[model samples]
Target chain A: MIVAIASGKGGTGKTTIATALARIWDGPRVAVDMDVEAPNLHLFLAPSYDGRKRAVLDVPVVLHPEACSGCGACSRLCAFKAIIALGDYPVVFPEMCHGCGGCLEVCRRGVLGAGKRELGEIFWGRAGAADGASPDLRIAGGQLRIGEAMSVPLIRQVRTKANEMLAEHPGDVIIDAPPGTSCPALSAVREVDVLLLVAEPTPFGLHDLGLAVRALASGRVPTGVVVNRAGLGDDCIRAFCHKHDLPILAEIPFRRDIAEACAQGIPLDHMGELRTMMETLARSLRELAEPRVAA
Target chain B: MSLIAVSAQGDTPEASVDPRFGRAKGFGLYDPSAQYWSYLSNDAAQAQAQGAGLAAVELLARAKVTVVLSGSIGPKAAVALRAAGIASVEGADGQTVRQAVAAHLEMPQRGDAKS
Candidate 1:
């Protein structure tokens, strides 16, 4: 099953929980970090990245201006208005273009051509035990190119690779999604079977969580909550979750030691409180992931 | 001489230009040769999701304005202005709408605005 760990607020311990779950997973699994703009899962996963592939976007570029009459048809058809007829050739803004390809279709003289730009790269690695044991977990994730306005394309690539691994691995695919309820966050959790909303117990966290839940209401994904740093705020989050009927799968209390270990790049494994919580989650996930028998 | 449109706070030549093009309160359309000015209310700027500058450009273009004096212009608005053969002039900030128009006329014409 595809499990996406997301947060409406950043720094809410998504990576902490996701990496811990990946470490304690008892079966074949692939953990992907979909926060391409600022990926940090490598610090926790400590995966050896042995392979990578560039992700490219096909944008509309102006070519063959000789065949064109400066009719401005393509520019008018563009939703982004990336295409514009200028003195000699129409100026094409590659950055603003979403690569929708309508300009090429609307060009009467075939003056428009397909151009490609690298959005990011997907790095695939293997996470091995600290003691030099054989790696059991496949780690795949991406990082968006600097100055690139879009992260959806890179996040989509990470998900694509994770889904491919799931087909072969027969295990859970946990996606460490980007924060907030924006397009990047939605892109990460779009096709997941289960989405873990990693939230902290604060008014702001709960506020954004409510907004995220409203956004996710339109999509078909089962969701659960994992309260990180659970003691900082009042029981408002608990009340909200209870009122919304969102299952509280786990609550990781505020721990200074865990934070220090994570900050120092130490794999936080077998920690008594967290391990028990992860174990319970793993069992519940196994049940959710199990294929239903034919009636 | 190119007709010009300046984002302005009021209808007269003494009114300072609004730096924000898309959200300007009003615009003053001027004919350089004739030294005449007229006002158009920018009622659409407040409610538009986007492309407010382009909409303002459309209004100016319809009035045969060949240059735009604004506090700022968006990328899409720049493209639209370029396509329509209209020049965008910056540094209009803190200048009156008429000063902005006169400034564009006084300076040596550049190929593009300083973004």
Candidate 2:
């Protein structure tokens, strides 16, 4: 089963939950970090993989220095306004360019040419036995280059590579999605069969959680929630769940050790209760995947 | 010269009635006769559902070159136009639709036009 762990806000322990779950379920599993813009899962997994492999997500634009006749036809046809004329020459902003190649097709002079810009890198590694030995669990993630704004395409590339890895070793897949309910998060969520939403008990958390929940519901994916740092906040999250008919799968209390371990690049196993809770969460997740097992 | 349509959004030719907040709304340029931009829209609504923006295919169906005069566009729209053999232009401001079109037509051609 494909399981995606997501949160509305950043720093709510979505990666912690995803890594812990992967560690607990000792089987053929692939942990894919689709937070392309800021992939941090590798900090915990520490798989000794090769150096970065450049991944490019090309955006199309018109190179006016070539065949562009200043006909303005390409500009007139573009819906995104990606093209603009400065004096007599047209300049293409690589960041804003989507690589649509419309300029090449529309140019009466056939001036447009294809060009690519590097967006990010996809890394692969195996978790060390000392960290949390799971021969079956292989970790792969994508890290977007800083200052790059296009995240959905990079996330899509990560998912595609993860899918390719899974095909080779057929097993359960757990995806750590980026925070928020935007296109990047949506891209991660769409590929999963089950979704685990990690939410905090703050007002902001609740608000973002509602957005995430709405996005998941719109996609018709079965979803559950795990309230991280549960002991700090009131019962607003619980009440909201009750009213919305959403399930509260687990509640992780606030712990300094967990925070320290994360800061020190240590896994959740360093904390006793958090590890146990993650194990239980893993079992429940398996049950959710195979409901008939309960019967 | 083939006709292409452009929208205010950067590269997505898809027609959206309501350009989401922070997203630009405008026409997309493409070779209208080639039907290349149609590949951008996964469904009919995305391609032709005219709430606010124009689909890349729809833009291509109308014109050969598109001049984007808006703020931004999503990646899907950009990829669709590239695949359909469309040309894209960006950074168009302070100009009306007619002025943008006129500027594009006056630009120099890079190579011989394809048959």
Candidate 3:
């Protein structure tokens, strides 16, 4: 089962919760980070990737300018303006192309050819426990190249890699999804068995959580909430979750030392209190995921 | 005699030039041969979530305008305009539509616009 950890508002502890879960997960599991735009899971997990592969998308390339009729059909066909017909040829903006291949299909003259544009890179490796006592956990993630506008495609690739890893590991896949309710976030949680929302208790957090809850309402995935920095803000988030019928899986109290430890690249599973909390959280997640596993 | 399109606040040539090429209110289409001026609303382009400038370029291209007089054109729109073979002159924000066109006519001709 794939369990995605997401949040509508950024900096609300999605990564913290995901890493915590990965560090203490009971069985064979893989932690996949889907925040390609600004991935930080690697910094916290310190996973020494064995190898990395480029993430590329198929884009249209103008093969023969001489054969072009300059009918502007390709330009009109491209909604992203990735292709535009110049005087007698079509100029392609590969960065803007969505890889739909509509231009290639529309071109009756066979002037367009398939080309690859590198969107990002994906890395796979294993992250071992800091104490070296427990078995190492498999980890995989992606990073979008600088100046690349799209993240959804790269996120999909990371999810695919996670699925492949699960075939070997035979355990829950913990995904640290990108923040917000946009395409990137939705792409990460698309086919997950459960989504664990990490939210704060502030008003802004509550508001954005509501937006996320509303956005994912259609997916009908079994969702639960984990309130981070729980004591700082009001009870609104809890109230909101209660009204939405989302179970409160756990809450990490607002503590400066915990923040400092995280900043120092210390996983929550290493801390005495947080380790117990992560263990308990893992049990709860396993229970939540059991229904799907049995099916 | 090719058509010249000027991004304008209003439909008339007397209206002030719209600084934005993509989100311009409308275009004042000037027919040099007929010495006539007409209007084309750019509402469709202005409403685009993205590629507004490219949409505006398409508008001018469909109108068969050889020259476009506007203030600032975004980099993407600029590329689209050049690809569309539409000559453009920037820094026409404060001038009236007619004056901007007149200024372009006074300048020495070049393959590309004086950006």
DockQ of each: 0.28, 0.04, 0.53
True lDDT of residue A213, candidate 3: 89
lDDT of 2 at A176: 93
lDDT (10s digit) by residue, model 2, range A1-295: 8889998888888998887887777678888899888788877777777445788966554544655566667666655555543324454556665556676677676556677878888887667667654567788888888888787777777777778877887888889999988888888888466789999999988898888888865535667889988877788789888988878888988777667777887667557777777777777777665642323
| Candidate structures ordered by TM-score, highest first | 3, 1, 2
Runs in model 3 deviating more than 4 A are: A130-136, A217-219, A290-295, B10-15, B106-115
Model 3, span B1-115: residue lDDT tens? 5788999999888999999999999999988778888999999988876678888888898888888889899998888888888988889889899999888777777743432
Weakest 10 consecutive residues, lDDT, candidate 1 chain A?
A: A286-295
On DockQ, the stronger of 1 and 3 is 3
The backbone clash count of each candidate, in order, is 0, 106, 0
Return whichever of 2 and 3 wins on TM-score: 3
Off by over 4 Å in 1: A86-88, A130-135, A167-170, A217-219, A286-295, B9-16, B22-26, B32-63, B72-83, B102-115
- In candidate 1, what are the lDDT values of residues A1-295, reduced to their tens digit? 6777888888988888888878887767788999999998877777888789999888988779788787778767766545656445676777767777888888878888999978989888888777432247889999899889888877877888877776766666778889888889988877667778888889998998898788753435667888888888888789999999888888888779877777876654556566778878766655543442111
Ranking by DockQ: 3, 1, 2
Is 2 or 3 the stronger prediction by DockQ? Answer: 3
